[model samples]
Target: MDKCAILPIADLYIRVSTEEQADKGFSQRYQEEVLRRHCEVNSIQVGSVIYEDFSAKTFNRPQWTKLFKSYKVNKGNRPQVLLFTKWDRFSRNTAEAYATIRSLEALGIQPVATEQPLDITVPENQMTLAFYLTIPEVENARRSLNIKQGLRRAKKEGRCTGLAPVGYINRTTETGVKYIAPIEPCASIMKTAFEQIASKTHNITQAYIHATDNGFNKSKNCFWRAIRNPLYCGKVPIHATPHECEQYVQGTHEPIVSEILFFNVQSIINKKREQLPKRSNIEYLFPLRGFLTCKKCGEVLTGSGSQGRNKKYYYYHCHSNCKSHLRTDKLHHLFVEQLKSFKLSENYYPICLKILKRTLTEEAALKTKTTYHLTKKIDELNNKIKKARDLLLQGDIDGSDYKKIKAGSEVQINILCEKLSALQNKQRQLSKDVNTGLSLFSKLRQLYEEGDIHTKRELTRLIFPEYLVSDGKCFHASPVTGAVKRLYNKEHSFTGLFSYNLSIKKELLTQSDSLIIEQENYETLGLSQQNNVSTSEVNEVMSLINTLAKIITIQLLK
Candidate 1:
């Protein structure tokens, strides 16, 4: 064990944890200087100088590992001492640090902390060594606990901590308070993307392609994650803890998309609506391929051409072992005829048109009312919580009862917030939708009859959300969508104007008067109001109608 006098060469092990690097005296340079001066004062030789910029949470530092390897591999000319500024510099993990010290001592190398010297020979000094090692470990635990609690607090405050998401960038206020601000084209692009996805007209791929065209710079996987992130909709996900399940908090940051739109996209992504993408020209024969199913067996109808003597005849038939088949032409004609019921007669057209516009206006106003009431209720609930807190502070109520009240109020507020978000989102499109729905109902027959495969499939999807069953001559869209219910409700006669039903939900035939409209804001659709209705302009507005018809069809999908 004799390294000879003046030959106890010490390997200078200077360590500074990442978080401590900016501190006044915890720098690696400071540690090196102290160790070198200690060596100079003791006439000790300096061996290899090792510097580590890592955490002392473990003995896994790169430099430490390499030195430990050298100690084990090469016995000759090895350092006699492993000198650092403190025991924590050696390791914050007490057990690993003790093991490492024993290993060094086994190799005839004494581990010395220049700042906190210990005489291993003195039995009582072992307690002092434990004290020095344990303090840093306790410090690390406390620091971690504080960080977690701070992060949880930030989430509850609806603050976006750490790096801002794709559409947002982290910013600091003039006073250095942190916040998230919407970033450029990505923010606008993302907002449009959410609306597109929510509309169900554009699938995820189409939305991605549109975004890319509009300067969306993200990979497909990244785009998927971006759309799924609730942060875009102003919801922050709180991490799960032992006492509570993971929750979503309304964020303070501005939302690129509404909560309703975000959730709608989620549902679409979750199942893609089980709706097939628009077919190509090759699939023109079966425009309703995915939307039509066998009335008998409930299987999707398959389209195929029959080989005949002179020409091939196309037909939709059950692929299963069932005898259900219909000529493509006949089914197409029947569907067109079914849509004719949607078209109002020239005599009653204006009256029905007025009714439709009035209904849309009333629906919009009802939604606005619903949104207002939900918000008001939420405020009232919050005030109740505040009052309960005051009572608890004044010793009027026990903590347990106050907690129950707070929990119940919070749940109700969450539900109301969700409903409010949906109403608000729908309201944004309601004005445009009123026009779109009127145009769509204007000529359901012509649109379906002339539309290409894409348009035809979309039209079918709206008319029949799940699938329509055709029993030879007629197509039956049971559990009818609200739009279709107006066209074919059993109780309502097409002999009259298009007042099929107003139930709005399940019954679809109730004569209940629940809502009134703000007539000033809503204009008549004028389906046949204009004596000289420009055909071209109607077509133009009709084109704008587009997939936004989904607002009317949301009942079936929502």
Candidate 2:
């Protein structure tokens, strides 16, 4: 046998990151060639060539793990040497690299960095090995910091710092500068979807269907990400670090949707999120399966479809010991009837509007006071933080004490900032929310009647936050506390929990007449109402009309 054939077997481990693949020295091809030549020259037999296109930040790489497992499983035929072009190619983490090397030595396998070879027998070469391994780690950290700083600067300059959001495509200018611009059909589709959602004509599911039909074939998660991303509204979110504050910067790109419409969609998304648990799958035709509670057992009612001799039958029944069953059609009909009873009369529309306005006004005043107090508290905390820093500088306070006080102040500041942001958002959307509330309240019955199964379920859940079914009827129905519940209960004469006075009607009418520019405003808003309302003032009036329409429908049902 040849002397080289008697040499111990070795495995060549080659790795290259996507970026490093182009570098001749660090490339996989280059590393493989170097290892092969080194093995041949050193009279070492090559047993296997393992190639990996992955990061060396950790030892959990696919090829590395496979090699380790194969070695352990076939100990009799295991390679005595593991060869890589350089120490950095083996691992970027020094601690992990040293530990793994120790383990390889114990297993009778010597790991060698071909280009930067070190004999383990020499004590000085061990230190040299560590120094060589640390270079790559330091380089990685510096590269990461540079990338982060570059992104931050780009964001500050009003440039799109990451991948373009849906509805927009990234384009490079002739000057080698990149910018985001609206893409054809997709931009239009996104715009229409936003409008539909804002107008309550469609939910997220409907919007998703519309987009998919228009060639937006992405995952449901991607679709939601598009909907929730603020980048479409001309704002870029700067992610916060542990010590930094989160903020939104105006982008140079044209907005796909207005701020008002964007926020309205956000509000709708939030409301839908709250009702997600109650949402039913299309497989189950009965939307109220999990919503209803068994009156006797206090357990949740279950729903199922059964096939009879002639046809299929759907029903809701108690799951526990209590045996209670009702046909799906009968329960749904009763629920619809109960829902219609909440609609208000036409005469009561103006009255309800007046009540809602007063309630909102009082709420706005209370919020203003709360915001002011929070602002003052935040200012005081900031002052304390400044004084603490000064004391630390002067050596009046120890570093630990200053840090504790600074951390506490920062926590308080962050809380106050969050509260302030919430209050500001509420203030901005107060009018829009009131308008939506009045509009939805008026069309409650019509929406329920015309909506699909999903919408019907959502409406039912919103109207009755919690309810119990017993004796083929819904009982203990706990409606959400707001204008809808108040008007619904009052109209049905179900309860006498009145919270407003009718005396405010005259004053409210006077204020409404002055705030609205009756005919011209109506024409501008494309409304046929006779009342004189300003173009800007038509939202509240329109809301009242929507509310009236719903109430009128329900009243006719009665």
Candidate 3:
């Protein structure tokens, strides 16, 4: 029709790299349709189509070269435009990219994108183009780095990182991620999975697939990673590599299973990995494996099994050159008997209470006596210095003598000032000690008498700080200032382990004779002796108790 009419396009080109052409978003068919619509609107003629479906790493692209040649020789109305999906689809390298743009401009065609047009242009325009592209890239990189750092920190704190392992469920808490210990509902599934794989009913791959199909779509690599991951074990893996394994970093989260069960699973996996697997002949139960130690050498006394012709039995054997081995059951029984003697309820309370009071009172008395002496000395020095100054300033002495006396008085004043400051600090600390001592002892006693299993465990750990079994006898080192040491034999040189085994002799009761009652005890015992006691006063008293307790019990008690 018209000579200046929109020129028909020669060819429609489309390209997408593997990295780009995912999720049908950058498919060639989709791009072709969009480009064709662009062509139809512009009245561009179609000569030939060129497409690239691989990487843009090099200029040796076949489809691109074909498009260049077609534009060069075609003597008819030259194709006015070379259309692509986007700028990155053209080329990633800047040099090759510019060359292509220049070459296209030299021919009667313009290199254009279905999305952004100005991006495939001069250096200045490309720089602006890079600025736009960099936003998403930088964000992606920052997110990746953050995730990596979070994983490292979580691992050091003993948290389970990444997806929950096959045998475990992710336990979400305010304290961060922990793996749920295998119990009831989930344990059956986990046990079955392990048993099936171990017995070769299904290989690991099949097991993984089956688990995934049955709503455990964490992936095969995830399953394998879980199998190798030591987070399931209570003893956290220091590092993925054996060389770095020695540097153990404690994790903060709760363990999914016990150390023994975790080790057993790991052993099974290790056997499968090795070409020539040597199966462990015996199963040993090391009850005091983590606790007991050799006095001569600080090495732990590990438990081992003895295989006889008829039966197999377990024993605790010292790894050091000392002959220390005993039947496992006997040693466990001995531990129970020793623990029995400790009497955590009555004996522990009276002993801990006595130690607590005596130590606190001693600390307070020390503080008070020191402060009193320092104050007395300060008063004496101040009086002496005042008299000296009066004598000098009253013209009763020569200028030189006055100066000498004033200098000497200043020295005494400085010493007194320092002593006064020390006394004040001691006074403050004594006040704090009184409050802390009362609270700590009271809580310990309550925890001993009415505490749950966990609380009792904490109390036991606090009192029985050390315990050892040597030559079929148990020994414990109770705190020197503790009730156990006070009521027991004072000359007995604090037997570190065997002391816990000693009976709570009746004499220990005498130590709690002069118990110093506290101001806070009135409200703590909940003895609202007077109904007229104001609610505000009661609330204030309760508020001082414990923040955690106050949050829950505030309304109920009020």
On TM-score, the leading prediction is: 1
Q: Tell me the number of clashing residue pairs for each predicted model.
A: 0, 9, 17
Candidate 2 lDDT for residue 411: 57
Residue-level lDDT tens digits of model 3 in 259-300: 434444555667756542232222113435645666566567
Worst 10 residues of 2 by lDDT: 492-501
Per-model CA lDDT versus the true structure: 0.72, 0.70, 0.53
Stretches off by above 4 angstroms in model 1 are 1-6, 196-213, 218-225, 240-249, 265-413, 420-558
lDDT of 3: 0.53
lDDT of 2 by residue, 214-271 (tens): 6776877888888788888887767766555556677888999876567668878888
Clash pairs, candidate 1, are none
lDDT tens readout by residue for model 1, 460-526: 7766657888887776655645434433344432232233333432232222344343242112233
TM-score of each: 0.57, 0.54, 0.29
Candidate 2 or 1, higher TM-score: 1
Alpha-carbon runs more than 4 Å astray in model 2: 192-215, 267-558
Question: What CA RMSD would you report for each candidate?
Answer: 13.0, 12.6, 23.0
| Span of ten consecutive residues with least summed lDDT in model 3 | 549-558
Give the top-scoring candidate (lDDT): 1
